[model samples]
Structure formats: C-alpha cells, structure tokens
Target: MNRRGFLMTASAAAAGFALAQAPGAAFAAPVRKALPRLKTQQVGSGDINFGYHSAGPEEGRPVVLLHDFGYDIHSFTEVIPLLAEQGFRVLVPYMRGHGSTRFKDKSIARSAQPEALGADTLTVIDSLHHPEAVVAGFGQGAVAARAFAQLKPTRCKGIVAVDGLWRPVPERAALQKDRRGFARKLWTANSPDWRFDEAVFARAAVSFDNPDFAAILTDTPSNAAVPTVSAPVLTLRGSASGIPVDDPTARMIEGAGHNLPLEAPQAFADAIAEMVRNAKWRT
Candidate 1:
C-alpha cells in the first residue's frame, strides 16, 4: 500500500489501542473549553455569511485568524483564547468555501488563489466594522493573509504565519519516489498524530482526486501572486519533526517555525502581543 494508506491503517490501529485503554485515552480531542459565542455577519456583496467567534473587549485591538485549506477556523482552538486573554480582540472565521459560508453566486469560480481569498478577507474585515486589525494565518491561510496585507496594507497592523510560506514543488527527482510515496510523506509530515476521521480523510482524498490538485497546491506558492505587502512578516515553521525542511524561505520572514506556536502557544502569543505593541502599523 501507499504511505498514506499505511499511515491511516497505523493510526486506526493506534486509536483502537488507545480506546481500549480508556475513552479519554484515544487521541484527546482539543480542549473542551466552552466555545466563544459565534457572530454572523454579511461580508462582501455576495451575501457570504461570515462567521467569527470573538473574545475580549469590543473596543480592544483586533487580531484576525485565518485557517488552512480543508480546515475550518477551529484550527485556532489553542491560540484564540490565549489572544483574547492577552487583551486583544480575536476574530476567527470560516473562509468562503468551507463551513456555512457559501459563495454568493455558485457561478463564480471558487478559485483558492491568494488574491481571491484576500478579497474575501477584506469583505469579512469590513463586515467586522473594525477600522484596522492584525492578521495571522496558518498553513495555506498565510497565503491569503499575505495577500490581504498586500491588498489592504492600511487595514492590517501585523501578520503572524504558522507553518506558512510554501515552497514550489520540487522536480520529480526531488519527489522522493512516486506519487503515492510523496502523498503519504506529505500528509505525515504535516500531521504526525493523524487524528482526522475517515470521513475527513475521504474529503481530503477528493481534493487530491483531481489530477491537478497536487500541482495546484504545491505549485501556487512559488509563483503565488504575492501582492506588495508592507506589513512586517512573522512566520512560524515546524521543527525537525514538523514540516519538511525548507530553510531559505524561512529566513526571509523575521519569524521562527517548527515548535513555534504548536509546542509553545504562550510564547507565540507573547510575541504577537509584543509585535502589536512595537510595530508602527499603517493601519
């Protein structure tokens, strides 16, 4: 079997083992703290129902959270509360195609390009009624975050990227082996615990079902239409155990990756708080 198949089989077996130990022993769900109330607003002309969970004073400085592809805003489960506790307004939302937010017109191309997403972000920000805010994104969301800053630099105070900055796909010689091998390794590299449900895995498989999906995701970054963003870029890469090593791009942004926000949420929070305090944001 391919690597992904093998890993899923392994994960299923491990999960079974943990379950046998105790219900709670199975891959522990993200902390079960009460979720902040969700607020719905219409952003952009398309009637896209933007959803945001906010915490902290309404008048406090704002920080926006953008998630990765095939991921809902909940990816920030570990980080949002901490930001709110630090006295910043946190807004986490479902991007256009995911969750309850549907495209205003089905005819519109659901292009997942950075520019398209960046525009969607502006609509969401405008709907929030916030004059300006800091934006942070993880994985593919970082692409949109950078685009947003490029498109509306005045509206963005700062940006923090966790596991952001995707390198262009390597040549075939660099792909390790065949497609199956690469897919499995790619999935495992990004998520070691592999806690996704079979249904979720199935959905991800569809995303890759298209012959072009892999190229689209892996190719876009190197050539992503990165707008001229003046906002200070802070990126967080995974450690040796995390994302596949790519050091050159990591150095461009004044940030750290690997065990950054994942292993150290508090440190990440502190760094963001400091960035807000120190940066002379145009927004």
Candidate 2:
C-alpha cells in the first residue's frame, strides 16, 4: 500500500486500540465542542461547492488559511482562534480533494497544481465578497497561496507561508526505495508528531484517491514559482526542516520542524499579525 493508505491503516489501529480499552466506544458518538465563532460553511464556486471553516466577525479583514497535504481545516484549530481573536476574518478551506470540498464535473481530474488552485482560491474570494485578502498557507496550501498571489495580484494584500517551498523531486537515487516509501517518508517528515497524525491522513484519504495531482505535487520545480509572486511575502521555516533559505524573505523558527504552525502557534500567529501590521491592512 502507498504511504497514505498505510497511515490510514495505522490510524485505524490506534483508534481501534483506544476503543478496545473502553467497551461501547464504537456506539458513542464524538462530542462536538461549543466553539464560539467557529463554523464549517460552504460557498458555491463555479464547478465546486467549497466547504470551509469560518471564524471571526463578518466585517473583519478576511484572511484565507489553507492547510497542507493530509490536513483539513482542523490543522488550524489552534491558529484560527488566534487569528480570529486578533480581529481578522479567517477562512480555513478544505482544499479540493480534501474534506468536504468536491469537484462537480466528474470528468475533470482533481488536479492540484498551483495554477488550478489559484483560480479556485480567487473564486472563493469572490464568493466571500472581499475585494482582496491575505492568503496564508502551509505545504501544498502554500503553493496555492503563492499561486493566488501570482495569478491574481489584485486580490491579495500579503502572504504568510511556512516551509512550503517545492523543490524538484529528487533523483531516484536521492529518494526512497520506491513510490510508497518516498511518500511515507515525506508524510511523516513534515508531520507535527514526527508521524502521520491519524486525523490528518484520514482527512486526506479523498485527496490521495485522486491520481491526477501526483505529478504536479511530487515533481515540483526547484524554483517553484515564488519569484513571480507580486504581493509581499513572509516565509517561515523550522530550524529542523531542511527547506532551503533561497528567498531573502524567508525566516526561521528557533527550534521547530516542518509543522511549524503547530510547533509554534503563537510565533506563527505573531509573524502573520506582524505582516498584516507591516502591510497596514485594515480589517
């Protein structure tokens, strides 16, 4: 099985073990928390019904936070509240092929190249009724953010990215033994727990099912199109994540790894808050 498949198996095992410890666990439904200002919403974009989590006041400055591969909106569970409390309208969308977002045209492959994602993002921006907004993202989501800034320069005020630079897929000799091994290595490398987070991979199962995105995602160019981006950009990386500091805009988290947002949520928030302040954006 591929890494995504294996991780789901592992996560199921873990959840099963927890259930075995408590009889009737299977029968008990999960308790939903009373998360004020936190809601999952949908917007009708052409050819897609996008599902996303919305937070903060309706009239606040809008900021769209996109999650990395294998993560849904929940990846921003901690960060969303932080941004929302800071008086920003935050939207964490389940990217195409992730969570509840789905493509309406059955014939279209679920392509996730930045170009496609950029268009979708702009559609969401229009749906939100915002003239323009800040686009911040992680991993593959960063690709989407940068793409949006590049593709729709007028629709973005600034950008915040964490360790999402895409390099050309290394030569086979420099990579894992095979496709599954390579994928697993990466999936765990950037993960918050240093392993596939059960919830994360489970949420990404649908994304993995789409074979159309593999080439664009796996064979990224070394200079993954950051230079053409017009808006102000702030790139952050964990000290441990080997993402190269090619761009002068890049910064490092003192002691962290790929999932820098989770490792240093406040610092991440502060960087974004500072970027908003620097750009003089008004909510």
TM-score, every prediction: 0.65, 0.72
Residues 4-47 of candidate 2: C-alpha lDDT, one tens digit per residue: 00011112112222322332322233444333333577886587
Cα displacement (angstroms), candidate 2, residue 168, comes to 4.7
The lDDT of each candidate is: 0.54, 0.61
Q: Which portions of model 2 miss their true places by more than 4 Å?
A: 1-39, 168-184, 191-223, 242-248, 280-283
- Give the TM-score (vs. native) of candidate 1: 0.65
Per-residue CA lDDT of model 1 for 33-128, tens digit only, reads 334434444344544555556677666687878765434455565676788876787777776545456656545555656776678778776776
Q: Report model 2's TM-score to 2 decimal places.
A: 0.72
Pairs of residues clashing in candidate 2: none
Whole-model lDDT, model 1: 0.54
Candidate with the greatest TM-score versus the true structure: 2
